[model samples]
Target: MAEGRSEIRLSPSLRGRIERFLAAAGPALEEFPPLETQKLVSELYVHQMELHLRNEELRRKQVVVQRFLHRQEEIQSEERFRSMAQTAIDAVISTDERGRIISWNQGAQAIFGYQEDEVLDQHLAILFPERYRAACRRKVERRRFSGMVPFPGKAMELHGLRQDGGEFPLELSLSRWEAGANSGYTAIIRDISKRWALTLALEGAAHKWRTTFDAIGDGVFLLNLDYEILQCNHAMSDQVRKPFGEIIGRRCHKVVHRRSSPIDGCPFVRMKKSRRRETLILRRDDCWFKIAVDPILDDDGNLRGGVHVTTDITTMMLAQEALKETLARLKRNMDETVAVLAATAGSRDPYTAGHQHNVAQLACAIAREMGLSPEQFEGIRVIGLLHDIGKVAVPAELLSKPGKLSELEFGIIKSHSLMGYEILKRIEFPWPVALAVLQHHERLDGSGYPGRLPGAEICLEAKIIAVADVVEAMSSHRPYRSSLGIDRALEEIFQGRGVCYDPEIVDACISLFTQKGFSFGQEPFLILSPADETGAAQGGPGPGREPAAVRSEETPVQKGKSAAKKSGGLEGRQ
Candidate 1:
């Protein structure tokens, strides 16, 4: 039995305990049977074997449990990675060394329009457009050899093909990795068709806007809150006589005014404070500009900057000033000419000495009282001075006659108005001076005139002159009569108002002498030459008197000849 049994291996401590047990039991067993001792030893060996077998089985079961736990952890970790990739917005794709698709997440499936089952094991080049397939292959080969990817770890834009054979823009980032002995690649991709289209559209709009800005005729500027120029049009560059590059980014004052600080009443400063538009006329180097500053605001209604527009108005301003100067000069010349002409006409008719001067003064006062414009008043005054110019054509004796004149003599005197019109029509006066001269003798009632013009038919200026003439002729000494007095003159016009005189003119004259306290000066008539005499005769009727008769009716034909000769002389003088 001992030969048949294998050797029992035990620990030193166990063997010590077994030997101590044998020593204590050996004397006790000496009285036992030999067969019984052997049998007991055999049972002790069997029990030791059973304990060793149980320990081995427990160790094997523990190892199996550890493996199972490790595998469960690994499965959970893989699930977490796949879930992250599937939920991501960007497409995630994995490929093996041969460039065959190994993994396609949900994002990849949506972006490529392909199912995972349909794309698995498919070549990665299938997702690339035909035009880009060769380039992709080249990059893959290069990466495998050099351990470097095309645009490694950086996003690149390229064309991608969908399952429906449609192509679109995509942004891709490629990275390489290793799993055991096999190398693979992961690509993070995103569809960028909308982004790219929007970018292109914005670029086109910006280009068009820039083109229009430069094409403007007025100077334009975009300025920040600090008044620094952010952008400027070509017109602005030209306005400042500087290049666009030099003007941009510089302070507006520095660029435009050549100053370090803002100008007084700076429109930009005002606009900034008020958050409103401002306009101003500015002059620089003899040039005038109308500048408009408009505020720029952000989406939140916050003031961001301003836009400035400047229009050149130099030509318009200069033209207006020149027109004003010309008008003033013309007025001065007209006044001087009228004075000279009145003095000349008065020199030929001394019986009505200073007649034209007094009439002109009174007419001007009437015009002022009537609230006439300066130009109208001036016309009335000039016409008053020249109203009797036709009397120069009358014979001196006929003009100075002191008795009632025959019809033939009165006819000759009435012809003077037509003669005056003929003479004056040749000159170009700004106002209707000649026409007023012709019509001054016309009456509103058609009862006292060469033309018999009545009422509104006569010009306003002519009516004013007629009123002044009547007043001055009656108040002053004349060849045909002594002074009738100002009261008699006023009475005559008041009685003849709306009959022979214009009511408006009559009222204005009355207001001037009465309410306005206007009076005529007694300055002696100006004589133009030695030939002009102070005793010269005039042709109009004196106050409240009939037409004067010639001193003699003899030699009527000779008288006509003499009157014609005198008219010619007067015409020559004019």
Candidate 2:
């Protein structure tokens, strides 16, 4: 029955099924022509089937090629990320919110001395020193609560632990990072030993600069552009007579002078504007400060502020002024002394008393009219008084001789001018006081005595004294002659103007005497003696002669022995 069932069925449905199945199995079976023809047809069908299978295989290969290219793209992308992570200098480390290390790059390994295998899946606390663990944990808790790390672009210096328990300084910048569905922190760390060294060096430099500034002996002050005192050393307070606590952080003008603001001539402003050092004279009560304001510059050459250095010059300036005043006083005192001395010396003759004083007064009047500085005037006054100082060495008998002097006696009297210079040259004085005495007899045209210097060579003071000597000797009663009137005295100077005397000075003298009605006898002379403290001798203040006080300054020569000397010597001499 099995063999019969295998035979072909004649029912139409079954037969069609069998035929279709046979044709599918072998297409040549449906043809069933001759056996040999069928074999040939089957061969041809098999050849076609083989060709279709080759086409299917080709399609499958194309799909495989596309998949390979897609996979290669993925591999390249992963390689690029790995390369960046491996070569980056800044440590790239990732940790879970709970402080577990999840990923670590080569940079992290190099900086922390740990391999990825040693740190990955480990607690983040392993990297922190034991002491910092609490702090680090607290920071992480804060970060988790805020969903942000405290550090971003700004890096914080800290210590990093190595795999071998070693430590190093590092700058760490932390940020929150998300990987797929997981949250973590990324920390970028840089070894910063070099930066730390620089920071220390900068601190040291700052300390040294402050020390140097404070150690200076001179008064030092720092001011802002607004002339506000920023800082000051102890010396500044001492010099200005103000306390440092009161001066610092206050406007300089207000603190120094108790004013509301800076004055127009404030030196700090000028220094800041000019970016250069400027010197100013500061007047305090009876003292002076030379304030030098120098610009403070930054490394980039920008003006930052100013440095004020104040030098106390009150002593030196006062000394100079005192010296000037002393010379003046000395001249007047000397004139009075000489007048008294001459009176004593000439008491025997009686007629020659007050001779030197009259001559000196007339000479000073002439010199002042010639327009000289106070120093020059003082020189003239001194020479006029001392012109006869050497005559002290001359015989009293010859001086009081009443009759006309012999040629030898006249020559001896003429030698007094030279002798006076030699006597007075030892005394230190400004403006060649002794030279004026020596050259008093000299003429501009070289026609006078004692090395007669001509024109400019003759001191204006000497020329004036020469004119005055002739006038006073001729006008006053002398032992040998009668008095000549003032008009005759004027003629000598007027004729000798420019040729013997300085023309301008001679003109001033002429104006004073002739036009200004100045005369030696205008004021009566008061008696002065060593016993008279109120007198014009002994360098005390006289009746109407007093010194004017400088603003906010103490007198250079106070009312003491020095003051006495100055006042007594120069009183009424000018």
Candidate 3:
């Protein structure tokens, strides 16, 4: 205190505050300082002002450093985002509020076939199909200020235009982003061409199958294991007299049969047990239906359910019934005509009254043994019954004479075959009846009367008749000759086999007598098994049962006739 002045020191802030107070209180405070102290107060004030200016400069530089650090962080964040978008399989695009392209990722470049340099600053509408371009531009313009909201995860589908001018389907999802005074939209887009094509193909296939299902004329339905109809076609609806809507999702039995349970003899029920197709003919509502069931199996071959198909067979059954009646009537009338013809021819010769009948029966038996078809045998029988018809033209005394005929009478007998052929040729029989009658007396070795055809020229029917006529004539009573007995008759044909008669027909005739125990006057002759084509020993109707035939290959006797009918290449059954 004593040495005239006290020293003073202050921090910059303190100095500044004190200087502010000194200036604001300057009139009194200026004098309060000692004269030396007062002189330095201005210098203190000047130093304080310089320090304040330096602090203001430092604060301004700190603000600049903070801004630089923030900009670096933003740059790093944007680089990371760009990297992610570049690697994405889908297109990623960024646009300004004006919809101008600002950033295009590698994915977007690949999808759109455009480089970033080419697309940058271009309108986003360049990537949209022509139809969508104007709409997209108008949409962005309308929302230029507010921009779009943050899009949800769901994507919108549209068509995208490519650099090649081709359009492909696209799925677009976008989100809104804002940074300071800047705001824009980022969109993720996917190419959906393959997916769209697959969907269309599936729709087309479904349409084709549905069309085929409905086009079927038969009533068809898919049945589950529970017998419920999962689906039914139009024909099925028609059959049940119900709409398709009423049939689906209902029990099959309830829909078709109008029953609580399955109908009796239901093919579906039988198929469950057999696991094979089962069919049934059902008659209901005056209509005939053929119901066929096929099983649907799983991959393991286990039965799953069934497909029921109902076909209307009313017309077919009725036609079959009508045909059967027509055939029966024709058969009866023909049989009567054959019997009458035989009787009229035999009437002239009193002893040969039953001779023609005996010959016809014996010829049929031989034909049967020789593996002839029913048609061939039938032709043989008809020819045998009428073989002597020409005898009717002769005087009654000549046929009934008790002595051997003169050479002139024998010549007359030989001419009967041609006469019978001439008479029978006028009728339209289904077989070669006239030719067979004409050749019945012809011999294989060219020794017999009339045409005297060789074995090859003679039809199978005539060959059979020749052997049967000889055997029957020798065994039976005749006015011109004594009964030689059955053994002698068979021996005659057996010795002449392949000489005067067809060896096959001769052997067949012998077998009928020796093995088959066949005789004349028997009402019912044997009708062998249809499968005895190899001449297996079909059991006889009565006492006669023959062993298996000796012939190894007995070809169909009427194969030529059957073929002729098919090709129209010959006369009637020729």
Using all chains and alpha carbons, the TM-scores for the candidates as numbered come to: 0.60, 0.56, 0.66
- Per-residue error at 552 for model 2, in Å? 64
Superposed by TM-score, candidate 3 places the C-alpha of residue 563 at a distance from the truth, in angstroms, of: 42
TM-score of 3: 0.66
Tens digit of lDDT per residue, candidate 2, span 480-554?
Answer: 445545554445445456665566655655555444555676643333343432312322223332323322243
* Order of models, best TM-score first: 3, 1, 2
Worst 10 residues of 1 by lDDT: 533-542
Worst 10 residues of 3 by lDDT: 565-574
Q: Give the winner by TM-score.
A: 3
Error of 1 at 251 (Å): 3.2
- Per-model root-mean-square deviation over C-alphas: 12.7, 16.6, 13.1
Error of 1 at 316 (Å): 5.7
* lDDT, each prediction: 0.75, 0.66, 0.74
Model 3: residue 20 alpha-carbon error in angstroms: 47
Candidate 2 regions off by >4 Å? Answer: 1-154, 159-169, 175-186, 191-198, 213-353, 400-405, 425-431, 452-458, 523-574
The residue ranges of model 1 lying beyond 4 angstroms of the native Cα positions read 1-98, 101-135, 141-155, 158-169, 173-198, 238-246, 269-306, 310-354, 368-372, 375-400, 405-463, 490-511, 515-517, 521-574
C-alpha lDDT (0 to 100) for residue 451 of candidate 3: 70
lDDT of 3 by residue, 32-66 (tens): 54764655677777766876676666678878999
lDDT of 3 at 248: 91
